[model samples]
Target chain A: MEQISPFKRLIASSLGKKYLMALTGFVLVGFVIAHMLGNIQIFLGPEAINTYASKLQNLPIAIKWGFRLFLLTAVAIHVWTAVLLTIENKQARPNNYADEKTVQASYASRTMPITGLIVLCFIIFHILHYTAQVIFDYKDLHYDLNGEHMHDVYSMMVLGFSHWWVSIFYIIAMGLLCMHLSHGISSMFQSMGWSNEKWRGVLKITAILIGAVLFIGFSSIPVAIMMGMIKPIIGH
Target chain B: MRLKLKVWRQKDQLDSGRLVDYQMDNISEDSSFLEMLDLLNESLVEKGDEPIAFDHDCREGICGMCSLTINGIPHGPEKLTTACQLHMRSFKNGETITIEPFRSKPFKITKDLIVDRSAFDKIIEAGGFISVRTGSAPDGNAIPISKSDSDYAMDAAACIGCAACVAACKNSSAMLFTSAKISQLNSLPQGKPEKDRRLLSMVSEMDRSGFGNCTNYGECHAVCPKGISVDFIANLNRDYAKASVKNLLKTIG
Candidate 1:
């Protein structure tokens, strides 16, 4: 009843938060696709992926960091709004159903919050493992390629995945990421009002395809490393 | 058929309810679920015990006045059937039935199995109508409508304002009901003029009612006596997104 701004009213409601989630989620999904494609270059050998990484790193600092900052902000908003909406949703049903049965919701849909939290943890660990290079010793792995000063991303990945525990963890994290995406993708379309009964089946199939692709593309690196298909480059 | 009933009993709105057990024998399987309840109430009255209170108007499923969560499923175990239409034969000979009121914050338990459903009325009052001058009835053929559009509109109009969707939802969301009304009106030529404003106001009003958000559980249509599809909710979400954008631009401009 109190006077409020239209924008404030827009994002303050449950429907508003869902719209926010859908928008930001679409951004994150795009980043995931691009990241997977870029990383899959490793299959061409150390030079291929390293060159791709260097090209990305060599961009203007403003452009590079600006994009990173934008992604980080998107992630923050997505997580924060999800938490608020979840709390409100919980408050809506104070008494839990004693003999509840999920008749139609998929396992992925039912476990979205849990999978989301797990994926968040994996993302933080992933950034620490690769981006910050602080989770493991990668100082010795950095070297120049072809007179161009570049980080040895291939060696770093090989070394990181060669360890059984890290490889297993990465694979597990990718699995959870796929599960998260399976539900999030179709749900994004639903929230955006881009889906209907006719296309609902198609949307779900598309979600599964995207999730599977990301899973296979990302995990292939670590799995291949563990299987000795990809090895650490001898030197610069 | 002999059955054991675990019916919820509450003194008043402030009091917490609990399920009390009662045995009923000689129940004919041909009798509807509500009729069985009526038989139980008759026996209770004979014993000078308080009878269970429930809401009912038409014994047929059309009215939707019956609101009960039978065995944790709204409208009993039968799909696309209201509690009034649910017969005793759906259960086993000695099966125990757990009957409770539709639980939601906005719908407070008024008594045993009856809860206040005026929250639905409040939602309808928000924007479920058109402002038109009173005049003689217009000919149905005055406005031409495609058969498909009319069918879609009628499908949505079949909703009986039952809160089964809310009860079946894990979060107690009312998206299905709200969307049905929005879809019904906005699809018609007569209701097209105020479509944008209607969507914005109705959705905001739904949010104001303290109902949970729809996560596409699909249970709403599964248990809907009228078989209202969750697709209407999707239709609503699409319209809402467009309306929100238009309204925001209008306000700023």
Candidate 2:
């Protein structure tokens, strides 16, 4: 491989880290917003949510695979970039706050990696349950809506919540995600330079709103299912 | 009231330093932080001791020359105000304030609480100007900048390059400072012609200056005397991206 030039070095630098963070962050934000919009369909009663799920499955095979591939790449790059940047930051400050100083950064900044790792595990587990059928094979995970079998994505979602232990863990994971994205999104805009006094107030409010909405929206589905508000598909 | 100060002391850039605790009694509550330090220096001078050295000018915070990290915070606790504006009333009658210089590779300390921020000057020289003829000044309304843009331009222009951002950053990144300067120019119509070149040059200079990369930490904004937002950093990136594409097209054309 040719030597990486100084120009390349600058682009790969700590400042360069912002480029990757901003790009992937924007991508994931797009995915989350879209995911939530779709998720809220569940609130429209079974017909809409299940039909939407079925429609998702009925997408052309090539398009379906394309979406999957794109999402996978985004997830990999997002997590990978974060892990590498966090390590670089850690190595830069080998020891810190000498003389027993109690001064500290916010919990989110300090534990970005840990929260990211937890969210990673949750993502893997989440995919296996919904995207992959084997893990939640025990949950009778299929339902037909609008004359199509969407791998019973809706039922799987509902059933995943019906299990008290699984839902509890999911609640914990989403809570961590809320903490991560809350700071992550606002920080992303700041790094990119869209931040100003007037907009700073708006961005902050938007960050908090996104975090609270996602936390409640994601957490409630499972909690509501576990509380018997939605029934598990027994079979057929 | 009397207070204890454990301040970082070093004779020069090459010297290793440590915090040395000094006690002073009956320090007036109304005394400015620097004034309190002056009292310590006065006592030391009278006792035939080496006076502690630091930096200050304008003593009003506008010049961004008074750089000090007090109690692990850049310019002490007040928001949107510099060390000069920070008065002694903010502190308790009996308190310990630890002071240090801004730590970053680009900012070499000449003495206690004073680091050379000439790297910022270098970056500014690299791109922070709009070329114009010296013969005559342009009419004020000729540019016609949108109100929103002008307002934000003022916000970005508010940055004083105090190095507080680097001090507060976990990575000691100067992105906030560089971006604010870039945005201040890049936002206005007058500054638009050089937008691409300015961003590319300044960002490149910032990296060349041995500053760490910004990790999107908001500490810099938190401690900034003028409250410059990180969004200017975003506009910087956008401009740079646009500039890169523009540069490429210009090269081809």
Candidate 3:
């Protein structure tokens, strides 16, 4: 019998595909935490966050673009593998069960794909709204404060959240991202082959807590802004 | 009681099956689901027509030979009950029950409601057993396994190899079935020597069999006649990962 390559075997197997998703998902998850922390700098007032944003912009091109490229590749592989697995799963059952019923899977687990797709859409919309500055004006990038012109990221964030619609969109997307994380976090361990009966409960609880923290941490910025807790920097 | 059955009929594995409507009258409420089918077959035989063909060996339900999808459920509507144990009384007098064979690429239809599940046997043959000496009977208590481990093993051992999990799964994945077998042997002391080998080979065969990947959908446990939990799946996955890592290290070292 002809032997198949181990490398081919790993990615071709169901477990292999799951491992890819779990690994990539963890990377994205770490990115989200870092992003939340960075975004929260706005709460420290204008000079603190603007300085921070400028520092990021001042980083060497290799470091900055390399990280962005890595993230983009991870996202691409994650989404592509997911689509392939879903197609294969669908083909497995040519005919749907007549009297379908859900017994044990949570709503979050079942809706992973839907929630994931929504998160993807939100990511693109977010880039357009803030990074590309194509959706709506948050603040003038060339605005001069203290006789020095730089991107007014703090004013941009405040202006973006000041609009009820944008804040609502961010809040809703973050909520779905929480749901996605809750299911993905626990499942990631399972795919990595570390889960067992004893750890199942602990893992599930931890996943929920992580989801809750992320939702609160990310959503707080918009909520605080909408409620007039954080105002645009005057005279900037 | 009278009941309407939308029974699936197919000539062979390659043929597309259709749900043929049949009316069954005077079915006793006490009759088991398979027994009701027997009654319907008797009527069809009397009329010189082809009887609905299905697989059932032990009407008592332990054999797992009986397989049917009654009203979109793998083992009828009852939870934790096989078709052979499901009584006609569970359904209303005039209810319509849709009966179909377990549909999955791995499980192909041989006839009316019977599907070829030998793919499961192939998977078992891959590495579902521990090597033992062919000698006089050994003392059962000699191994001295922990009570908790023994019980956990038994929970997995209870699986009867029915494909109900596959039928119920939206993806028709056999993660539950495959995992049960893995966990059953993985928990026992005697099977420890071959644990890594067993997991890798069995999973490889499973992937080759064209079964779908599990998305952690709990439908498999919900429709399981033996009520196997999805926890074993997590254990199996964990073991598989460890085995792969061990195997890779062996190559590098």
Q: Interface RMSD (Å) of model 2?
A: 3.8
**What CAPRI grade goes to candidate 3?**
medium
Interface RMSD of each: 1.4, 3.8, 1.9
lDDT of 1 by residue, A1-236 (tens): 67776687778866788888989999999999999999899899988888999899999999999999999999999999878877777877776554466667788887777888888998998899888979897866666777887888888888888889888888888888898889899998888778888898999999989999999999999989988998777753
lDDT of 3 at B241: 74
User: Which RMSD values do the candidates have, in order?
Assistant: 1.8, 4.4, 2.9
Sort the candidates on lDDT, descending order. Answer: 1, 3, 2
Best by DockQ: 1
Model 2 per-residue lDDT tens digits across residues A100-169 = 2223356776567799899989889888877776676834555565565545556667766777888888
- Measured against the true two-chain complex, the DockQ scores of the candidates, in the order shown, are 0.60, 0.24, 0.60
Clashes of 1: 0
Clashes of each: 0, 12, 2
TM-score: model 1, chain A: 0.96
Q: What is the lDDT of residue A193 in candidate 1?
A: 77
Error of 3 at A85 (Å): 1.2
Task: Show the lowest summed lDDT stretch of 10 residues, model 3 chain A.
Answer: A137-146
